[model samples]
Target: MSVTDQHGNIFSIFNDLLKADYGIWLWEPYTEQLYFNSHYLTMLGYSNAEFPYNIATWKALLHPDDANNIVPMQFKIIGSAEYGESFDTRFRMKTKNGDYMWVLSRGFVVCRDEHGKAIRLAGIHIDTDTSEAIVNKLAIQHERMRFALDTARDGLWDWSPATGEVYFSPRYVEMCGYQPEEFPQRVESWIERVHPDDIEATVTKQLEFVNNPEMGDTFECVYRFLAADGSYKWILGRGKVTRRDAEGKAIRIVGLHTDITELRNTQESLAHLINHDTLTGLYSRFYFDEKSRQLKEKHYPLSIIYGDMDGLKLINDNLGHATGDTLLKTAASLILQGTRGSDIVARTGGDEFTLLLLNCSGNAANLILERIQAAIDIYNTTPDVLPVFISFGLVCANENNTSVNKLVSQADKNMMNTKLKNHPENLAIIRAWIEKRLGSEIDIADTRLAQVHSSS
Candidate 1:
């Protein structure tokens, strides 16, 4: 009987070791049988029902740039060369949602023929490198890394898998706020201090390094480790498999840790600044455009409302720019009050704004329009300030005929039409406000105002 017919349960061999916390794959070269755990499917945002578990199907999801390297390595792992018994590399694979993620793939040959040919294989796929900074943190040369580690308040750890013992550096005691005696010694003791959320990935990387001697000696992972205090600190743990048994299993591992909490916080603050408008606190145009492109592939309706503040130049020219800024801020506040919480309001330009209304119907769009006009009217009810007027145009888009560029063009046309329709009344309102403000200089202002109105 062929191995395919006889060894249906061969995939279960890896189950005892991994317990499904990580994504595992099993294959037999002679039978061409491939099996992947459900975790593997879930990691790529797919279900076995939706995705086939064959080499060709999986290869189709590999990023075009990665397929060239990944496919050849797959074949080489089970080839005639006994030294090529391990498969290791990083590659980008597509998720079910049409996005790509970088994953570290490592495999080992589990069975061989009498002639030392490979017959069966097992491996894991690790979702790593969630952030670019995570990868860049490991780029330093040996001397620079050692010098920095020595200067900074860093920690070191040494582990022996066979003896089940661990060694913690004195710096580790300082960083953890622990006494020398209280520092972790056994592997299990150290494992208890890792934050619950980070324990799985941290342990998996350790297993990956130990099991595959053919992979490089280096191992690195970032996780939150609990300190002697009640708090947890983000630690970048990098290590090397310093020794391996005759069977290629890891015997000793040693590494260092660097505190990265401040770096993480800074990155988060910078990210917020990138995605949000500094002046208005609303989403930026770049964020809006990015989201709009993502939504293009989804089946949903969107209401695009484009708006421009009217008479801003007039206000700035007559009053100071400070007054103009206040007017812009006031407009932004009223717009936010008029729209729903789910709506994405952005300051796209100096005097322009755009709102992306989600799942919005025609009635809902009309209601939003009325609410904004009401807000403007209520603001105008206050005395002494220049009247605030903003011209708006809207277009409803659906899956049938909608795209980012098309929606923008149509909304712009509508906005121009609305602006033309509102210009005369808005001009009159501005004229009234200017007449009221320029009491002593009315004669001089009249000439400039007349010129403005004529040219406008």
Candidate 2:
């Protein structure tokens, strides 16, 4: 399948050109047998080459990009129930002199097995520029290009500004979930289907070249097109003024449409991953910092809260990391519930979280902290619930505070100070709970707890 549909049509076109070809060749797929007339070898500047050349030899002589294009069409014809389906394609063939010559190869499914699989193919190569077959060759080449475009599922648009008439290729209409006949053959029909937000930007670019043809012949833009499913899909649109008036106004504009929805969605998904925490669905540290910078520049008084789950390591070491992760999620939920919709909450690292509050005073920050603590208390009252607590630092900056780094430093220092006082007691309580819960199946070393406390 290296060569796709291209080689199939290429073979058919070349079959018609056999009337004025430079060389002839035959190949058997199953046996890998290959034959070429002396004129063929001489055409490729390989004079006096021995007989019995393998199909692989001929294939190896094909330009690398072309080999794949041929295989698809080759298999398509070979898989047919009928024989003698001709295909023609053009590709550069490597000559014995190491130079590449553009050769037109056409082949036919002359023989097929009982299973309808093509076994043998014979075709001719038209010279690069044969005077007698130039017209046929031109038409064939145009067909080849059209076939390739169809194979790619790309849509073409030809617009006549004066008449408001437009030709939308079948594939183009089909892509938008419309049957060719059902789709209007007018540019305005297309304009109506564009997403409202994107229509202005998309249409303006096209009109720029149409109104002032001197601006350029080509323009490309990405926009959303409404589909038949009532959904908008991303499309990369490219157009050029094919014909212009004597006064420099565009007459004909032709272009293509390529679906890029999947690509665009992938990019958006990656951006989300980069800016948000995977475990907590909160903003990531990078996002928080960037938001902080923006808020600072805009002269908003901001409160930065830095916190971490107390005894997180003790829970992980005693019960396993799974239990610890549950504790973290619970803490994140409580924190998110405590903050305003306008506030930004982020999981900066394992067991660590931050919150950004705009235009908030120190009292508002304390109120949010108190609300979070209340949530923790309510959860602790439930039977068999593991203890949840956070050691935190609250720092505030007004419009005049220009340095975010200093705010971060003061917040970290205050949170760590609270952690120093609160961690040991939290760890001890968690240890006792784990002992009773698990019947002392696990023991946590004080040294490890000390390392966790100091590291945080």
Candidate 3:
């Protein structure tokens, strides 16, 4: 009889003996073929035709946690005689009803080649979902815990104080881009992976929590961990003492490590958005106000450089808003480049900018203003899309009682005076520059008329 006929006959005999409570399977390792009897199909809520009878199908149904650890052992048993005649393992297998059932798989090599290679294997599957054995209960609990951790993208860890040994779950090992055997099961193994800068603080906090149980029930910390690829990843570690000594010292702890790099980056981005101008990449008025208050508390010599763009409205009216935006961005870049990194450059209004210069006198302010003017001169020399011009006013507050607001107002008044004096000339220059750059296709008449009317 053919192998298929023989397997069918054997399956029929076992069906009578086990009364459908158990399932049988036959595998050909050389051919990578698989067979599941009718009882096996029925146990998983599927008919023989509904399920694909293949090794891949069998592997796909195995729980991920079990599969990672078991696949190699399965190969070792079939490929060598080290496992000694038979192998048995308990794992969760997905049923057709979308739930996992605990199963006990027992198998042995049924046939071998002339060279003593195991070509065929046979296994019996026993549903252990309701088994009363302690081992079975533990296996079921472990599978359930694995499901929860995998779903939450968390890695579980258990540490023993007595032996200094640590148990890292498969997911935990994989989180660091490591195989289960790659990472040693020791507390030092985990500590060694912590980034050097964070290790001291993390260890101190952990020790504090361990020494004082009354301080809190749970300990939490966030730090960077070195992954297998040699890159650091942000991890949030949280745990509680599950076992304690008579003196209330922590003896055993169970915890989880979660990858929080994305969340941390998102939080940093939100904080930047809150304190910075979205368009100009300068400090927003809100942040400027806060810094102003802080600088006022320290009685340092402070200088305020108030600036207004000369012809934004003219540009917006003749060219598009996009062109107007370019003018604002260029002004921002020039101010940033001209000022010291310590100086706070802010875009506080539509066409207005302010600089907070700490420990700067009026002489220092003048030099900065000169630097800005030089930058503008260079920009104008390059026949760019738009001509750049800015009116600036500087005021220094050295007195202990001098209010920042008063200095700001004085700078604003001075800036307005300069703007008024240069507005007419700046508009005429802009008109000529645009006409020269883009030719007669652009209209400068309406812009020039608006400038004259505004001056009137």
Scored by CA lDDT, what does every candidate get? Answer: 0.70, 0.72, 0.74
Model 2 C-alpha lDDT versus the unseen true structure: 0.72
The digit string of per-residue lDDT tens for model 1 on 1-456 reads 111222223332222433534566665454344667667778899866777545668888999999997777777656666457666689999999999998977676654544565555666666885454633332222123223323444466678888888877666667767887786577776678888888679986677777888776665567888888878887777676767899898898776566776666676798899889887788998988887876743535778888888777767777778878887888998898889998989999888899888888757887998899899989888886668899888988666465767887788778877877786688678766866776533222324334545776
lDDT of 3 at 124: 69
Instruction: State the lDDT of candidate 2 residue by residue for 1-456, as single tens digits.
Output: 111131222222233333223566656554454655546777788754333356667778888888898766676787885524677678898887788898877666554444566555666676766665674755565444334323334566778898888888766888878876668888877888888898678887677779996677666678999898889988877666768888888888776676777667877998999999887788998998788667644546678898877777778877899888888888888888788898889998788888888888888888998887788879888876788888889998776555777887788888878877877787777777888977865555546347657787
Q: Give all candidate RMSDs, comma-separated.
A: 16.3, 14.0, 17.8
User: Once model 3 is optimally superposed onto the true structure by TM-score, how far is the C-alpha of residue 44 displaced, in angstroms?
Assistant: 45
Which has the higher TM-score value, candidate number 1 or candidate number 3? 3
Best first by TM-score, ranked: 2, 3, 1
How does residue 225 of candidate 3 score in lDDT? Answer: 93
Q: Candidate 3 overall Cα lDDT vs. reference?
A: 0.74
- Which candidate has the highest lDDT of all? 3
Residue 284 lDDT in candidate 3:
93
lDDT of 3 by residue, 1-456 (tens): 122332353233223333433566766564355766667778789865667655888899988999998888888777777565467789998999889988877676654443454555666677775455744544444343323323335566778775687788777788779976779888877888898899777977787788788876456678999999998888877675767898888888777676776667776898899899998999999998998887653646789999988778767876779989999999899888789888989999998899989888889988998998898888888854478888888899886577778888999878877776787788788877666756754544434435645876
Q: Report the alpha-carbon TM-score of model 2 versus the true structure.
A: 0.61
lDDT of 1 at 326: 84
TM-score for each prediction?
0.53, 0.61, 0.59
